[model samples]
Target: MTPHMNTRRAAALAAVAAMVVVGVQTGTANARPAAPDDGSSASPRTSSPAFSSASARTAAIKSAQTDASSTAGSLGLGGKEKLIARDVIKDAKGTVHTRYERTYAGLPVIGGDLVTHIASNGKLKGVTKATDARISVPSTTAKIKTAAAARKVIWAGSGKPVLAFESVKTGVQKDGTPSRRHIITDATTGKTLHSYEAVETAGVGNSQYSGKVDLSTTASGSGFELTDGDRGGHKTYDLNQGESGTGDLVTDDDNTWGDGTGNDRQTAAVDAHYGAAKTWDFYKTALGRDGIAGDGKAAYSRVHYGDAYVNAFWDDSCFCMTYGDGADNKSALTGLDVAGHEMSHGLTASTANLDYVGESGGLNEATSDIFGTAVEFFADNATDVGDYLIGEKIDINGDGSPLRYMDQPSKDGGSADYWDSSVGDLDVHYSSGVANHFFYLLAEGSGAKTINGVDYDSPTSDGSTVTGIGRDKAIQIWYKALSEYMTSSTDYAAARTATEKAATDLYGADSAELKAVDAAWSGVNVK
Candidate 1:
């Protein structure tokens, strides 16, 4: 799995941002009308007890905001600090998590966001802040144009090409990179105020799994380099059991590659390359996204990472994907869905930039899983048909079981089938079950079903059968919500709003698609 930050850095950040909420009093179930059991409810009954009353929730949020503002000084906030409540997640247990944005001296502080966990008795249990530094900037002057700065970033090729403005607290990022170095650019001057790494690196050659695939090769003096001149000059490298260098650029005189077996090292490369190409096509053709960043640029892939390495990851630092040969170096972990899942991490980073922790982190993982499944379906390969199971081809569990089941995520020991207050406590991978289940219910509805020879029996939280809006509509709604409506701090409640908004935008306010979106969230207990 691709972690949002390096393991050590992430742990350090977590320590700084940790919050604890103790003594939660469980509340009684507050139910409304239920969806029709005929699997054709035009408008389903809302199942979110916490958010059922809009006015009450809004009042609670206002109270939480006032409480947060009153304790600003105690929380280490400056005099001019303002807290804007972004979301309020309340559990049936009466515990509340209030997410907020901080503004200092009337300017938004990029990393000054925090979450306040309140006990059922209205006692402030703890607070989690991304950064505790005071917000202060020397100046907002710029000597470089925004376009030029972005161009410089692209030319440097150290990371993806994107720019923003943020005040520097310390002089370095968690990774020890220089921070707050870019000058602020005026709209007329085309200068931006801040810069962050946008590219994420992590992938296949004529893939062993995808059979023959189109390769973008450049002619070298000796023969040909495994570089795709067409797809933003993307390339694939063999790590050769070594941990670091970009290995060698695969080359061939005849341009015929791989023998579909691990004995021939190039077979894994073929799978990876083909997977990358197909993933690119999935985004472009299905969702109108140009590339991982929607910038028409390509990312590179590294295979044969370590001895018997059983995992793959997308590293934003190098803007590349890395894969390990599983078990005895026989499983290359570069299947179509695997490639799509890894690459979608880059997309999630560039787009929603969902915080890789708690519920948002689960959404991030589920986003990758959703797109991975979509990519598999888009390919329509005879060898590997699309299914709702994640990592079905990788055999990561060593027992022939898939890593996750979207239809009923609880089928896996770790995943949760429905949303709950404690869902956020689980690992992001397991917490992702809520969103995956929601997507499955949205696309295929509730009940026993079979898709591409795979059987699925999805149940609803309130025993209400749901009628699907079809996978095509479901994907469209999810993609629009992810790319346009969702933000870095979006959680399950906000996700419900985003998907509803997306469906309304794409299929009209009174359309069945919108109804389906609402029903799907309700089915997952998100409401």
Candidate 2:
């Protein structure tokens, strides 16, 4: 739970020359991103220069790989450890931020990820590590079997390395969402090391709120199916009040779909489909991400999830998005921002994989809110104009109020407007308010204002005035932090560091963006 296992930094690095070959849970369809089919490491080639352009992604990754290989020993990496490049980003000034996953003795080191920052001249600037501990385990043999370890209660990590066994349990939660919980235990002691839920639940469109929108559908048998051919063949499904399994592919004789009312079953599907397209476009157009997983593969969507379910979620297990009908099945949860929120969960899962509890959990949720609001603004649809309010259209609170207020999160009553010593103890939904408030202050400044006809008065915990940096730069800094600098265990403190580094990389060491990032976090009491 502590940021990056720093307490274990003093652990001696074990001699790994004669390390035993161990079977590690490296990838699963439900928990991790897809890997190569040939069981080879996906490390980027290190023989290229990273030019300063969008097409230089491969070169940037390669540059990072080269740096990682050279700096392993200095970073306390064992001889048997190898770094697998997860992502790489190059700033306009040619600074490179490389994200990597570690394997020791060919075993995946859980929570052993780091981001390395390199100057354009190839000098290593610094490294942000998820754990400062060096890998040192006596043996790779497991004394306790997976079945027995599953019954034991979870224990906290001491930042020490141990050969661990991963047990994946798949089932359904009480809320009818699929669960893919990964349980890790000490291989030798049979004590539970850690357990985390992999399902990142949380979107979409419509003819409902968004009047007369266009859709991307594939031609079917004398009809059109809710399949987007342009964006990785993305499709939308109608769950038809069922809690499990994909119900059916929503189709129409013509491409036209849904009325403003939710009376037609296709109405909800239309909204979901439209929202998915817009969200996809937002990521691609604004952030350069191809899709939810950034592999140019689209995660599908499910609408009308259950009878009056009143919610929405993103399931990494199915690589899909699900939405429910609100009260009386009259309101669908498929707003543009809602769709963006659900899919961003998948984006987070595929990238940072932020832990879904404590301060890290709050960060995970706030990430969705930030990107969800960005998507809404990016779309700029007339009917559902972009605003700082979350879920204003769906009305989850039974009042005409939003589920969250970014400018003043405390307006929702349950959310925190600022961080404190015990902010992590709050529910993630409310603790997220800290970051939400920070984002609002960063994007719109700390003061009274009106945007898109909605009034807001954002306050600062330190009573200091903050100037706006505009949402465009604010979002870029966040996405960089989330994708290249953050890890599974990042908290608010680590988050501030990550964003500062991100800002420096994006705008330079002394840029206004960097200063604004600091002031905004201070306004939220994160510093």
Candidate 3:
């Protein structure tokens, strides 16, 4: 099997457009972070006007150190309480409690008591005035017209990270689209490079990405085909399939392509197209970066990677994204959160570039899941509504439970929301709890609350109250911490170090941001 074909029943092929999945077989390996272990994309962005306030630098530091020494560890914590208060801090915006007591990337709820209290160094600003905050559920679900009149209108002069290109003379299909034999143009130079023949499987046409092509069809011969000029011309490519899967041949480059929508391939296509577009927009607009790599780098994703693959991942060598349809017993693994999570692997690769082996690996995975949830909120799709719940739409386990939960990571089968010294050694899914809990406590505060009819009880190490600053502020602090302060081998303690630094840097030690950070960590039992 190719590097992309790790131990799944089928593998994907994106010759020009992600097409179909060819059935195969394989061995299982330890679950690892699906990000490329290359190119330090995690380095902080160019620090535009985004990173100003050098004047308050020293004051913030001294205040942060004093708050760290005074507020944390004063509360004796264990279990859920410890998890809730993991790394709380305060800042000018008020106390921004870490959201997850043990979960990562959970929704944020902001509002708390004690706006400003005198720290050893001085009084922190932006402290919460009340301890109660509610979820800001958005009521907007307006759909926009995305289908363009012309193919080029949707794809021409688009922005994505494409390093190099060459042209080939390919052919046009009966559908009036370019085939493999049609002439290709270089994206950068607008020059013709070469001519080639289309791989004949009958009706495969060209797409904007894969060019005109039909990799396969239903027994009835009506299904989805590639659109020319897809994601700057790329698709999942599989080399073999069905009874055709063999020993020497199976291990060969027999990659095909398939969509994740079990019922209709077109549905999957629409979702993928929309999901990618929304994700790209979120990062570009909210964070002010080019793309995943902050350099306009574009990556291709292949759904239905292997038969019943049941998982999604990213690989470094290929710089590709892959997902599975499902087993007869299971459902497709492609949900908005799943898509967001997988893409986050790409983001993690470019920044902090955390190791994907053990504890750090768990942090890496949680980061993807965390950011993935946030991206869902950013999209606000109706069919795929935004919530703290992950995999709400994709019933992968058939239990009505999502793949992971930000408010309570443990609600899922194999997630941990709190951090013990040993948590970093657990599965990445579980290890993610530390950060998850941190975010939860930071955004929502500690104690009992009801959201969307779901019952939750956020606890803190000290009996004192933590406040919520919402997910928006929490995410920014975490992003800054990850990109600026975190390094490989960082465990729960290290995360505290990083996030505290971030809170102080972004808001100020004496700012409400720092106080919230301190309280949030305390709620997660991080103290």
- Count of backbone clashes for each model? 22, 11, 149
Candidate with more favorable, higher TM-score: 1 or 2: 2
For each candidate, the alpha-carbon lDDT, in order, equals 0.69, 0.72, 0.48
Instruction: By lDDT, rank the candidates, best first.
Output: 2, 1, 3
Better by TM-score, candidate 3 or 2: 2
Candidates in order, TM-scores: namely 0.63, 0.65, 0.56
Model 1 CA deviation exceeding 4 Å by range? 1-9, 12-206
User: What tens-digit string does per-residue lDDT give for candidate 2 at 1-527?
Assistant: 11232322112111100000000111222222111100012221121123446567787677667866666877768898888887786543356777888877777777777877778898888887777777667766556666753432212145666777778888864334466778777767766667655553221224887787877665443445777877877888888888778879987764567767878888888778888888999888777676886656688988886677666766665677777787689788888788888888778877787766678767888888898899888888999899999878777777788888899998888789999979888866788889989888888899998889999999999899999788887887888889888987899999999999988877788988789999999999887
What order do candidates take by TM-score, descending? 2, 1, 3
Q: After superposition, how far is residue 501 of candidate 1 from its true place, in Å?
A: 0.9
Comparing 1 with 2 on lDDT, the higher-scoring candidate is: 2
Off by over 4 Å in 2: 1-206
The reply for model 3, stretches above 4 Å from the true place, is: 1-261, 450-455, 461-464
CA displacement after TM-score superposition, residue 60 of candidate 2 (Å) = 12
lDDT of 3: 0.48
